[model samples]
Target: MIELKHVNKYYRNDEEELHVLKDINMSVEAGEMIAVMGPSGSGKSTLINTLGFIDTKFDGEYLFEGENLVTSSDDRLSKVRNQIVGFVFQNFSLIENNTVYENVELPLLYNGYGFHETKERVMDALVKVGIADKADKHPKQLSGGQQQRVAIARALINQPSFIIADEPTGALDTHTSTEIMELFRELNRKESATIFLVTHDPEVVPYCDRLISIRDGAIIEDRAVIHE
Candidate 1:
């Protein structure tokens, strides 16, 4: 549901232009769990933002679910983003003051869901992420893994077609990371949530159906791998 062809992202700094991504070509289909692995400064996050419609000024074409992203308006892009792409970041970007249920309900609020519908969707998302019992808890009260699950619940509240995760397991220990990866796998396999994850952890690589390596702002390797 995502495609980038010859994509080039540039940043202008006084007298120099920094090229972050160069000639990036990628395609992600439905129900696929793809991991983007690379060293630091390999443009993994940049590519993820571009795919998620969070970044716009690039030199090539990006198509999402058959629509040309470059031609879409800002309003249209926002709509598409809200409806199609769910994002999970390395930091659990939840509001410290809000409860888990409230945090997960933010997206639905923006989508104009009624009170009853919002409660139902938010509760379902929390349950799906296995954190429904913590619905009343705040971010500071939860463990790293639980907080990440709340973030995942927020991401899933919209029932998005795809999820873009940037270092989903970065802030956790190995065991917690394993649990998070397993959750992602189940989401992909059972709920058909297409996931594009950016990670550097080799241990987490085996869980992905596709492994993509990036170096010097380009995709060095993109191949299907055996998943356990």
Candidate 2:
């Protein structure tokens, strides 16, 4: 579903050019949960930005479903980004003023769905994430786990080609984190949701089907995760 070839990213400061991503190449199949593990200053965020279509200032090929987007126009990239990728962040990124229902509905509305047309789609997503009961509540009224569930629901509402989760379980306690990871594992198992999980937590790696380790702006290991 996704491929990156000979990808390299550079940053400029003062009179120096620093290379960040180094010869990054990766391919993702459908319905796979991949854990991207890296520490600080390892170019992990840059890679995620590249894959999620938020960064196009790198040298190389980024092919999503066979179309190369390296040279696409900003408008074209925006369209593709909205239509193909769903992003979940550590902060949940929910609107505190909006009800859970409204928060999840925003994406559909942006995609051209009328308000009346969003109820079913919104409710279904909420239900899938085990948060249908919280639809009427605001973000501040919910616990961290519930809030993340809403975020996951919002991400799923689009049925995009994949979901990019960056530090998805970062804000919760260990128990809540486990619950969220289990939720993700179940989603991947039952609904075939393709997900790219960006986390520095080793505990988060086991829930994913594949493990990708990066350091010094390069992928050092790509392997399947085996539960034992």
Candidate 3:
């Protein structure tokens, strides 16, 4: 459902140009779970932004369902980004003032769902992430794992075609990280949810179906992850 062909990104600084992504060629089918890993200054962030539809100024084509979405209008791209990608960040960007249900309900509201129509969808999302019982709780009252669960629930509430889990397990302890990864795997397997996981931890790679490594502003390796 997604393809990047000979894509390149450049940043201008004075009279010089900085190449961030060079000749990136990738295709992702629906229901695939992929992990991306890279060190600092490796251009992974640039690549992620490009794939997530936030960065459109590039040298090649970004095809979604066979159409070049990168060349679309800014307003169209913004709407498509909202409808096609859900983001889960490392910091668990939840509002401390909002209840779990409220946090999960925000996306539906943005998508034009009325308050009366959101309860079922919000509860289902919470249940999917195993946090339905904590719907009334606040972020400060929950553990880190639980907060992250809420974040994942919020991401899934929109039912976007792609979930961009940017270091989803980064803030948790080892045991909690394992639990969260297992949850993600279960969702991928049962729901056929397409996941694009960005993580630096090698331990997390085993849970993914494929891995792509980036270095020096280029894709150095892309291969399937064999689970044993």
lDDT per residue, candidate 2, 1-228, as tens digits? 899999999999999999999999999999999999999999899999999999899998988889897578888888788778999999999999999999999989888899888999899999999989999999999999999999999999889889999999989999999999999999999999999999999999888889999999999999999988
Q: Which stretches of candidate 2 lie over 4 Å from their true place?
A: none
lDDT tens string, model 1, 147-197? 999999898988898998989999999899999999999999889889988
lDDT of 3 by residue, 1-228 (tens): 999999999999989999999999999999999999999888888999998998889999899899988878898888888888998999999999999999999988888899999999999999999989999999999999999999999888888998999989989999999999999999999999999899888988999999999998999999999877
lDDT of 3: 0.92
Which pairs clash in model 1? none
lDDT of the candidates, in the order given: 0.90, 0.93, 0.92
Please, what is the TM-score per model? 0.96, 0.98, 0.97
- Model 2: colliding residue pairs: none
Taking all chains together, the TM-score of candidate 3 against the true structure is 0.97
